[model samples]
Target: MFKVIFRVTTEVRNTAGLREIKRAGFIPFMAKREGEEEVYEALYKSNDLEELREAITEAAYFLNKVNRKGGNNFATIYKVNDNYVGKGLGGLLGASLGLKLGGIPGLFIGAIGGLLLGEILDVELNETFVGVYSWPISIEQ
Candidate 1:
């Protein structure tokens, strides 16, 4: 599991511009405010950085194309990681729930599921990156 933070300017905020990003198989995990800019984090499950890079390239290309064709869009990306506490706490909660519901088998299944969820949450909590491109264009209506 790898994390990628796609930072774009809030000057052009619209979900329609994200079509290309979603088409590229990136999952929008969270969004935050950084001073006067808006930042968005996305998740990607790739075997390595090379694979993630290819998808990111394609996504950037798509965004550029959209912008050239009268769309107000610009974005930059970065790689990030998940924290430890999220993984541990998620597993603990899952195990507790499983134990209350069933026996050992339930505990195992619950722990695994919880751990995965927790790892994802950790990524959302620990994303920090500087945006490369910032566009202040307006959407063509």
Candidate 2:
């Protein structure tokens, strides 16, 4: 199995895109909003490299279709070597935890720690957000 992460941006109402495509992607784990746009992050897998790419393009198609302004959607094949996206996620989590644990100083420490761990995930485990980062979602009760 090819370990990977899939990501895309969709209309908030259309976040169900990934779930619909492969029926295998994890529910989005992160949501980031920029001004008026939102993106979602998820980690999952496929049979192999080829299968993974197919799922990603399918996700890209879904995301693009629902975009309000004909925006471009994207996906990844299997994984990226650097996996900066994972690092970013780690950084965000670290920062939040740091704030809670030790305030501003801890924030820096947490971010660095998270980033290093993310790097380890990318290298040792070959697990990282294999797709885009320029996108978010939540489950509603």
Candidate 3:
């Protein structure tokens, strides 16, 4: 298994922002530095290096998009953060694709497409208002 750390920087310190990170399945740690508010430090772990990398990428993408509008404007100042729970979901998905699918190329294309779809669904479902959305729900009988 591979372990990775990601730092998430935001403009303000509040529960709403932290909740977003937590809901995404990340282990969030906050620290208040001189002349700065609370900043979130997130950690992500995966079963493989590739999966960890992919999770970092996905989490970065999600964080960027979430902060793009007008509020938080969080940026990844340091390593990619994926140690949270939602981030784990992304890593698991990548690992599954690698194991069940064919090669790296295929996995890359599939993950990108999946991420796109996830964003669209997040918008189309009108769940973005509450900062919660459905993520590729699967049902088993």
Candidate 4:
């Protein structure tokens, strides 16, 4: 599965601007101190591979539509890998639980379910660009 994350970031003092972002299909994601500003980040995710690959174009389209209306909205995409420990860990947890509940069949079922959940978690984690500051990246040193 592919995940495309679109992010909008602004200073904490400009939180009121977040309302507009929300209306634009962005959702609150995180906040943190960056230099002199407390940055707030909001994101929108697209799981379709085609959309993910073309996220920049979508961002350009959005900017074209909104900017013409005197909107200052800006968006950017972050790239991240697919592999993470969560998937394997979740599969193991699921298999153990499934084995306890229904032996071989339950193990397989639980593993599949757990793997799906883990995949989602990994995508979200990647969306945050894990291992980086939780703030507006550009503002950081």
Candidate 5:
């Protein structure tokens, strides 16, 4: 399976937009809101790009139909190589363990060893696509 990272800005706020994203097969993991600007980060899992596209299209349609007035402004999608996250997590864990087992020196040594092991174990060739929105949702009512 492949993982996709989707980011979008829309007038739809909070739980409302989250529901639509979930319906599109994306799990909303992170979100940031600054005044009127809301950016959402989500992860979508699919067998291939085609399937992911279909799901995205469906999401767009749903958003357009529901919001109508406040539609998507900008959207981006990327195929993610999730190994880096694992590597970082592993390194932190290793560093903590090392510190407990030894001390400051052990922390550095363990972190390096853990990071290397994480990199070796997690490698992926994922493509990235930017601004693939074919039909931008209307922001005007």
Candidate 6:
């Protein structure tokens, strides 16, 4: 499996934005913080690393597009699990998840499920068995 981590800053609380992400098709693993502004840790998972990367890139693109249209500001950092290597399946799983969700929260939830499913299937826990992706959004002070 492959994991990516990222941090994103937005113009306002992302409750509705997150919901929109979900509607786009990704899964949200966790969310926290509060008040006028907030931050969240999101995850996206896939059986393939390349796919995961593509998905994350897509999410970032979408978020930026949304922010640009609304005149919001955002930033993100994506890191892949260096320890994890690819299998014969390539990075299709991860890529598929990212393509489907198009956002952080959805990616996180999908990753969790993918991880669980991989375990249940007895997929080998190679260095890349797990992937981690995060997004932290904050309102401009």
Candidate-wise lDDT, in order: 0.64, 0.53, 0.42, 0.50, 0.62, 0.44
Q: Which structure among the candidates has the greatest TM-score?
A: 5
> After aligning candidate 5 to the native by TM-score, how far in Å is the CA of 40 from where it should be?
1.3
Report the error of model 6 at residue 135, Å. 11
| Candidate 2: tens digits of C-alpha lDDT, residues 1-141 | 343334443446544554444454433445555544554455444445656555544555555555522233333334535457778888899989999999999999999999977755664456444444222221111
Tell me the spans in candidate 3 whose CA falls farther than 4 Å from its real position: 1-3, 23-25, 29-39, 68-141
lDDT of 2: 0.53
Across 1-141, the per-residue lDDT of candidate 1 in tens digits comes to 555556544345556446766778888767665653445567776647667667766766665555422212344545456468998999999999998898898899999999989988787677665334333333322
Best by lDDT: 1
User: Candidate 5: TM-score?
Assistant: 0.55
Q: Which parts of model 1 are misplaced by more than 4 Å?
A: 33-37, 68-91, 94-117, 121-141
Rank list by lDDT: 1, 5, 2, 4, 6, 3
lDDT (10s digit) by residue, model 5, range 1-141 = 333333444565656666776787877666676565555666665547777777777766665565522334345666566658758977998899899998999999889988867754453344455444544434333
Superposed model 5: Cα runs more than 4 Å off: 1-13, 68-73, 82-131, 136-141
- Candidate 4 lDDT over residue span 1-141, tens digit each: 322233333323444443444555555455444443333355445545455434334433443333211112233344445676889989999999999999999999999988978866775676533222122223323
Q: Local error of candidate 3 at 87, Å?
A: 24
Look at candidate 6 and tell me the lDDT of residue 115.
Answer: 56
lDDT of 4: 0.50
Give the per-residue lDDT digits (tens) of candidate 3, residues 7-92. 44446444554555555556554434333333455543333544544454455555554451112333232323222343344545
Task: Using TM-score as the measure, name the better of candidate 1 and candidate 5.
Answer: 5
True lDDT of residue 9, candidate 3: 46
Q: Which residue pairs in candidate 4 have backbone atoms (N, alpha carbon, C) closer than 3 angstroms, thus clashing?
A: none
